[model samples]
Target: MSGFPLPPNATIGIVGGGQLGRMSAMAAARLGYRCHVLTPEADSPAGQVSAAVTLGGFTDPATLRRFAEAVDVISFEFENVSAEGLDLLASIRPVRPAPSVLRISQDRIDEKTFLNAAGVATAPWRSVETMAELEAAVAVLGLPSVLKTTRLGYDGKGQAMLRSAEDLAPAFERLQPKPLILEGFVDFAQEISVVIARGADGSMAAFDTVENRHANHILDLTLAPARIPGAADEMAQAIARRVAEALDLVGLLAVEMFLDAQGRVLANEIAPRPHNSGHWTIDACPASQFEMHVRAVAGLPLPPATRHADAVMKNLIGPEGMALWPAAVAEPGLIPHLYGKTEALPGRKMGHVTRLFPRGALPGDLGVEAALGPLLSPLLSPLGVIA
Candidate 1:
């Protein structure tokens, strides 16, 4: 965007058309800006709400060119787009966070190397190109490690665990696209994340560190102001700021981290867009994560990421969650948001509901379950085990 505080009518182009882009477009509408979406699906979650849609593959130069010409600025909802495709978009329009940032995040090897080089802590890892190397790396990282594809892995996909030597060959053979990364599993006390945004002028704002609980390897609940020690909260925020500055990031970034039993925070993954964990900010904060993302990409002054209330965001996944839509809507104090998807496929994220509490009044596990009522599942554990 050439102009500072991008004028109200400017159209912000988003590369992927998932729920992240959908919410981001909704937020941009509040600021008087229109959103243009690019995706292969004709009736995508984002295209449903956006002003315009350019349906095509992200890598096709012709489609990329067409999508680029339709908007003034470009950003992405996910990291699956090829780096070459983003480079093409950058030549036509300003791509916030830059293609270089995407390259670092697109590959696990690059992400881990960058994090360690940035003076941020992370789990020990080694690159594997062949079975021989996998065995040697496993010997060092030890049993009970994880093997993951270097690209296109999310929601517990593209990764496998090696509990015994018998598990190694089968996993290595099953995982696709040669070149994998083996990570030493962390015996952590809890899983947490921090979402932050940085403007073109170097100003930054970060949300409170929140604990994330998962069910079947998918995010099920996020507790705002993670019920951890005060020191751990400060540490998580510090790690996120360091990463934003290191990347010279010009958009939103979410740092997924693990708080080990030793009370240390280790970077697990980085997503350069709005994250699922930050959804609570929609009801808890003066400025939601989506608003901060649009503001940063539009060159607006960054505001303090402050929250007015505590909240718990629960993801509504698959058929079971969709089954509760009516009750969720009727439940008092339950804030519901459903994606415009016709089918609630298994493991598909259909929508989310949020429950808010008075500032600093977030309750413990039993209370959270009780409040969630119909939506609550006992899979949540306050002292989460990361193994």
Candidate 2:
């Protein structure tokens, strides 16, 4: 904790220039802060809008040093930032969601180990440092399991599904050189996430848990005030709180969980920054996730996280998002956000749209649930929207 306020107009250095950084920079601007975006791409969404842009790879030490010197504090949009790069910047300025936190979240083996050591329940998993060890891990976890790279995997990349004993070697063979982790498949009923913020002074606040729906390993939709039962919601929040305390974290952390058929919540993954599931906060809550993340990282006090509107956020992937933009913009209560991406390649996250309803106005009131069929229905419908 700095034990002092980061006054408005302070410059914050952002390590990645994706949509997350763009959103965070927007929030910082609203609060009278300036952003210096450091990334390799010149036309990145964040770089296009930020106060300053440093075009350099994360491995470029000299560029990172100059970037750190230009800002009062630093934070990252993505978890895959090189440890050596962040270490260089950390020497010059405060890096929130600190390097250590990033290290734990970046590696599957370390992440699961940290969660288990923190007394948090996660999917049963074992680590593999070699091909033989991978076979042993598969035997212990069982067939029909997931083999994930220990590092640099997301959006379902760098992972393989092993349906039988014969699949183990091939799965491991495909992801050679990188260590691995195998977990027994979870027969869960629901997937949800809690976006939490912890200030430098240790004060914490959390947005309502969001019910998440994923397709092809990428998040498709997120509904706030997750349609889960009261007890399940509380349990999820508690788990998030425990994780923040254990990590001694500052800035936003997204905790992903799975609710099994019996309604028990199991931790799935953790992101040490604002996440896709929290996008609904932009249209539904008083303080959006991006704003909270900036506040925490800048050493500002945490604000109350109050959900004033019920909301559903849908991610538009590939060309479909652009093709349907006209309809989205014409829809009442819909808020569209398009990233400054030129090409609309398949499976790429093009943008997102959020629909907000007045407080206490639920899907039942608007027939929204029925309007959203299986093809595009919001994820929270299974539990049914209460507000």
Candidate 3:
């Protein structure tokens, strides 16, 4: 805040070294800035591209001190970073989507509470600290609910569905030492998400809403410029704007919402950093979410979030997704991005493929309905082409 503006070439310190960091580093390089990656993995995806790599535990003060000293500003790829780690780094440089916001986003129970206090509607949920609390939660929320740990869970891990009275014990049995939250089942018609970038100057810009389809609790495909009435689309963006303003959030934030059986939007969760749902921006938008995050953290003014083309982003999960890699790479209008990960295990995000289209193409006009008619046809027919 002291300096009026940080110039390009100022180094950015990025926490976590997954694909998000990798993409963010690439974006930083494009803007004439360098990235310093801090993670324990020597061969981390982000580390490979960053100007500097600090290999150590997230809680290691010495490593964090060295990392903070090396960069002009800091940001993170994930929400689960240690609060202390961020506090240490923030003392040295500005950390966008600041540690205070990170704390609320990192825990499900706190996140839900914060959202509710902000007057955002969410699925009814209760905190569970003990078996008694879990039982009581189930009693109030009823059977057929989801029990999730308060922290460090992603991709359906650390979450269990309690379909009946008999399922409660098992759900609690599987949960680790962390606290938990049990959410009442929501009969959602569809899921949608909004991604936005808030600059340090308090100005905000957002991309179009996206219709998301998930498989086994993992995001599968995201259709950009979600087919909805203009009013409903505005409603979604308004919700995102409210959430961003509530957090006084900086950098990219993804707000996941559920369209209930009644077609009403309800908040599902908040992701403080860039999200998989916004992956299409890399291919479809002039300034992608990754670039926006870097620009915001570096104290640069946010760029226009414009979509040059409508796009479909599909995630490649597990072995089946890996097998389709070669074919995905061969498609003319498809952009294939593979995370530098070996051994594709079940439910792991191996990579993604984005299909770009001309602007304003309808679902049928752009071949979306044809391609997604069966949903799983891409795996069946190969190259995502209909047989």
Candidate 4:
């Protein structure tokens, strides 16, 4: 083994046993590493696939120590894993991306501050701690702004739109008792994300930019090689790289950005693990994001993140997604991945499907729609699928 490599038979500890952990465990197994999953829930999606599982709360010191002792290194699939838990485990075993990364990502104020300090531009925003401060923020940012909790918000939860003065009190009332952030909304042309992986040796690889679409605040579809002009595509990747380097990141980082009307890219959020937008890489790229993450954390050499095919990734959310499973399996060129969640609750991500086409083919390519018609016609008719 090399000086940095975690030898083949070593165990990798994973925090947050969700679908991302499940997929990361699968990739680690392929590279000859065993995975031990830690989560509070029994029979977690990741636990089902891992070699060992410890069921306990993240903040429990005993649980953290026991888990740390069993694994050669630790990595988390979700950002919400307790920072205190990671700090305890780090004394026993290495945690890639580090606990500091978690602290920065878990709070909106810290995240925006870090981004701006790194010389990345973000939407105009103000920190609001009380109703009076919120009112003051509104006077400056004006109506049509977004009010979100400073921490623990995702997928549109903990967020409210303030479209008019009349909406302020109700919005404040709904999001009160917790710190808040009011952001002046950006009138953007499209949303895109760049998923990049950085190795322990500082080697980095970035996948093709992905265009994202959302429905009811949930990720709906992702099209690889987002149809922006070449310059804008390069700019997005550069911004992602800068953020990763600034964070001193040693694992995967996903930078979500908005392309404004003038074609400027503004950082919106950063996820310090394998991300939903990069799902297309599983079918279209030389190395999937999950595998790249494993390689980075295990000290294995990074692979070139190159796309060989045009791809479209669609989320299977709720009952609507579950209903398409039968057809999804039978469709040619479609790769279906179910998260193994027993309950298909509304807004929950049950699975995803990726369809690949020839390189250079756009969504509007003649045969793309015809090929995906059967599997997507029902769920995507209203929202429309981007190529």
Candidate 5:
């Protein structure tokens, strides 16, 4: 933490060469820093833009050591990288936000345990390791709840909704890797998130609370400065900043939350790197979340997380989303960012389009579609387009 603001030519090592890493690397380059990426995929999204790429398994000892030795500072773009591998890298070069922070965010059990203890509100949950425990947890949490793997789950992959008694045994037998967690179902009115960056000296910058709308559990669009009441927005941002401070984080962290029907904010998940929800900042804010991440890990002074324009960020997922690319590019006032991805695979995030509004001019649900022009189609469900 002492000698920093990494020299201009110094390289920053990033684990997981995904789209998040790609954008972070692009941001780093703008600030006169170099990036080296490590991933198993050949020609990974992040690697396409980075100065160097180490193609290897996340747990490979040789690759971890070699990557650590090459960079002045290290950070990760995603949380799926093995914590043990990160610990190995930390021994050779500084890993900002620390491996300890990553450990807390890696597993749902550990994450929830940390959040509740940190005074951050979260859904009622119980860990289940066996059929008896599952039954007991179900009895306590009740019939309608969510059963999920405590690790390696994202985009709605590792969860089952239990609505009836018949769902118990089948769901319990189907889920893999054992040791699950049961969360009491929350009647949420809206989904929102906040992205924040914390520096080594504990200085922090938090972006506005943004509303997230999803389709099939994949993010579809995000509204910066969520249309919720001011108090609810404040609560969401406060939870994010609190999580950053609690972890003593020195990098970007995005905290997703459920604003319940009663106007209470409950933390859902925490990602210690850039999040899909924060992509709007790339076009709306002077210092994007990616830039905040680079500055924090490189020991540079943090900039205000200020935005000049209100923005609606739309995700380009799968082949359907990719189809809109031509219109997205042709439309005036739409800022397009395609993640150098070759294939438009199903459910994959191919790229994104951002539409800016004058400050305080974000439109209502009905108006949002008109603002987006030809980007949205009738085939999409109303939830994805807010019809």
Candidate 6:
């Protein structure tokens, strides 16, 4: 873990062979590093791109050991990797971002506690382990709050809204028999994310803050250089850097936050790998988040996080996204990236498209939605444009 650099041609093991891993593998190849992907899926996206792949269950000790033995270092694409599996791998080889980062990020209660203890502001929240505790938390936090499982929730799953006393029972019944946390909803002006990479030497680089727009609780679009005031953008980046340094992060970390009506920023959640919001970096920034992640974990010097152009990134969810492929490919300044997923299940993130504009060409007077709508109208019209 203390190695200053891993020479070229070294093997990097990636756990969880999803799109993040796929992109990370591609980035590693660009740097002359080979990738070994370990996942249970035989046709995983990362496996398709990596130099080697070990197909096995994450918790299988023998498979984990073999994977560790094949690679010079290890990193993961998702936070859900079993802690025990990571511990076993760490014993065999180094796991960047560290097991402690995953331990905190995989659980909502623990992540919030760590952030708060590090002097980061989060929504008012309290832990609830039982129906009685849920009731007590409701009484204290009040109505219109979110009741979510402390672990394994993503893309808005494992959550229920408690709007009134009548909602308490139904919400509790739906999410029962699991550890929960109730978070008071914040009336926010914007939802922004700061994607940063921290090197082993403690150096950190942050991408431009992105404003996210969600539909049905799934991230639909991201606009880089968030339309928020300059001061709020700077504050968001500062908070994200503080979180990364506090966690002693060795790879990429995405900090999602809410800019409240009073312009106060509050941390909402953290993703330990490359994030959907940072997809804009692929087309706009000199060094993408995936490349930065690969460099950080591989002990390579970090790249400058500079944006060459203004950009808008849109996720192509399900069949609706596939329908727009023809138009997307024809659009000028548009870059389309597909995950190569076999099925286009509804609400599934199948791919994304980013459109870059000349510097200063995009009008700052218009809001993010307004500025990007015309450019993406062809692809979005069929699915009902995101407002």
Q: Which parts of model 3 have CA positions greater than 4 angstroms off?
A: 1-4, 362-366, 369-387
Q: Give the residue spans of candidate 4 off by over 4 A.
A: 1-3, 365-370, 377-387
lDDT for residue 283 in candidate 3, whole number 0-100: 94
| Candidate 5 overall lDDT versus native | 0.90
What's the residue-level lDDT of 142 in candidate 2? 84
Error of 1 at 146 (Å): 0.5
1-387 in candidate 4: lDDT tens per residue? 223589888898898899999999988999899999998889788999999999998888998899989888889886786667778988888889888988899999999999999999999899998889989998899889999988889899999999988888888889855789999898888899999999987899999898888888889878777989788898899999999999999989899999999999999999999999988888888789999999998899898999999898888899988988988898877899998899999999999998887898756533545655665654345246453
Write down the lDDT of every candidate, Cα atoms only.
Answer: 0.92, 0.85, 0.84, 0.87, 0.90, 0.86
TM-score of each: 0.97, 0.93, 0.93, 0.95, 0.97, 0.94
For model 5, the run of ten residues with the poorest summed lDDT = 378-387
In model 6, which range of ten residues has the least summed lDDT?
A: 374-383
Q: Which stretches of candidate 5 lie over 4 Å from their true place?
A: 381-387
Question: What TM-score would candidate 5 get against the native?
Answer: 0.97
Best by lDDT: 1
Clashes of each: 0, 0, 0, 1, 0, 0
Error of 5 at 358 (Å): 0.4
Locate the minimum summed-lDDT window of 10 residues in model 4: 378-387
Ranking by TM-score: 5, 1, 4, 6, 2, 3
How do the residues 204-319 of candidate 2 rate in per-residue lDDT, one tens digit apiece? 99998888878778887787767788888999999999999999999999999998888888999999998999998988887999999998988787889889988878788888
Quote the lDDT for 91 in model 1.
Answer: 96
Model 4 lDDT, full chain set: 0.87
Candidate 5 lDDT, tens digit per residue, 10-81? 899998888999999999999998899988989899999999998898888998898888888889986777
- By summed lDDT, the worst window of 10 consecutive residues in model 2 runs over 374-383
Worst 10 residues of 3 by lDDT: 374-383
By lDDT rank, best first, the candidates go: 1, 5, 4, 6, 2, 3
